[model samples]
Target: MDSVQVRPMQEDDLPSAERASAVTFFEAERSTRRVSDPEAEPRSAAASKQWIDRMRFYLSVDPAGCWIAVDEEAGANRAVGFAISQNRGRLWFLATYGVLPSHQGQGIGKRLLDAALAHADGRPGIFSSSVHPGATRRYRMADFSLHPQMRMVGTVDRSTLPVVDGLQEGQADDFAWMDQLDQDLRVAAHGPDHGYMLDILRLVVCRDGARPGYAYLDDRGRASLLAAAHPETAQKLLWEALASSQGPTLVNCITTPNEWAIDVGLAARLDIGQEGYIAVRGMPVPAPYLASGHFL
Candidate 1:
């Protein structure tokens, strides 16, 4: 551990940090699958330009909230762990945190987390976490209330899909209304993150009536982020997302307060499974919201 040091994450560290995260999460998922479905092959995390680009975006927005643990032993400055977070107004959201399996239990993760958390400056915080015991314990010690989260995954039963009304293709003009909805639901607007998401994902917006809502759908037509002023509006947006899917889809980050989402998924005949936890501090789990793993 003496050879390892946690320091602020730099643009140059993005590739190595992303690799560390990929390996860490891959092993974690493999371990979980060994218990839940012994025969299932867990998805592997491969390096991608998109991951580095996303981390670069986070660094551009909140460099102070990102840290990397590097081992300098044997003249190799290898990234063994990393934590990336961002501050959106008064809210701090952790984008990614991970320690390589070879480096686990060496206190590198704790040190990286502490450095990243220091950037929060006592503001409210939130992050979607895996069911790993050590990680959950650390989050609990940080005072975040862990809310069990569920995910719905399966090929949507198109026969059960309903006609969702008022949903239109969103444009840059909808950012103002979408940000307001974000503020109402999560205590702070997503701000610039929306722009990045819009560039890569499809934005479906329903600003037709008093109950406005918006959802960002990935290329596969899966909802990546969603929020609405009312449950009915949320359900409509979610229904549209599911109906638009080209193949198997997933709706994640379903907290207990968002039963409307569960109803929509169940109605679509998607299988429900325990995903992880949405750890939050200084706020309750937002209602009718599906948070982005990298931007919540």
Candidate 2:
């Protein structure tokens, strides 16, 4: 373990970091009781590519919070683990973290987490949605309390939704508006370069002539209700997103704090899937709307 070195991640290290994340995550899930749908297709290449994009996005916003663990004995300083974190106002989040399966039990992950927490510096709240039980346990040991959650999946039939007036499709140009909304609603400024998000998801907004809310849905139909000025706006935006998506649409990290979020999930006919836990330390901040499982 002493042969491993921890340092801030460079842009060049992202590809390998993504690969390490995939292997570690896949192997970790396989070790658990979590079952996969037998009829489901093998993991998609696009899914793998999405991890790379997400890591890059997190890095773009919080470069200092990203770290990589390398095995110095490997000569090339091979990356064996990594962590991506961000401070969204008072809410600090561990966006993602993983150690290569082969490198487990060697303290690399601890070092990476230590670096992330040091950067966080006991911020009011730090959060994560942990996929693997081992990860949940690790976070628990780190003094983070756990909240149960799930991946809710269902058919999103837009036909069932009454046409909400003033709702319009959003574009890349709406990045600034969305960032401002995020700051106002969540007290977090996620920055304004989200134009890149439209490249990966369908951006939709509910504008009461003044931008009440927005949502993002990818090609595969995974949708996230980013933020809403109020419960009614959140409902409308959620309905709009559900109306527009296809296949097995998903919303991750739904908790008891938001009755409207849960009601919308039920109204959309989303079925509860594999359970996960959101771990948080410090202040208990409410997250009625989450952008994605990976982000929160």
Q: What TM-score against the true fold does each predicted structure earn?
A: 0.95, 0.86
Give model 2's TM-score versus the native structure.
0.86
TM-score of 1: 0.95
> Considering every candidate listed, which one attains the maximal TM-score?
1
Instruction: Report every candidate's CA lDDT.
Output: 0.88, 0.71
The runs of at least 3 residues in candidate 1 whose Cα sits more than 4 Å from the true structure, single-residue gaps closed, are 34-47
Write down the lDDT that model 1 would get: 0.88
The residue ranges of model 2 lying beyond 4 angstroms of the native Cα positions read: 36-44, 88-90, 157-159, 209-211, 285-287
lDDT of 2 by residue, 1-296 (tens): 77888999988887778777777877766675445543323346887787787778778888999999988887575789998888766667787888988888767777888899888877844455555655776787788888776567877655556777767779766677777786675556556335556666787787664537777877665565467777788777777666766776777766666567667777777777756766768755354465455554
Q: What total of clashing residue pairs does each candidate reach?
A: 0, 1
Cα-based lDDT at residue 275, candidate 1: 78
Candidate 2 backbone overlaps, count: 1
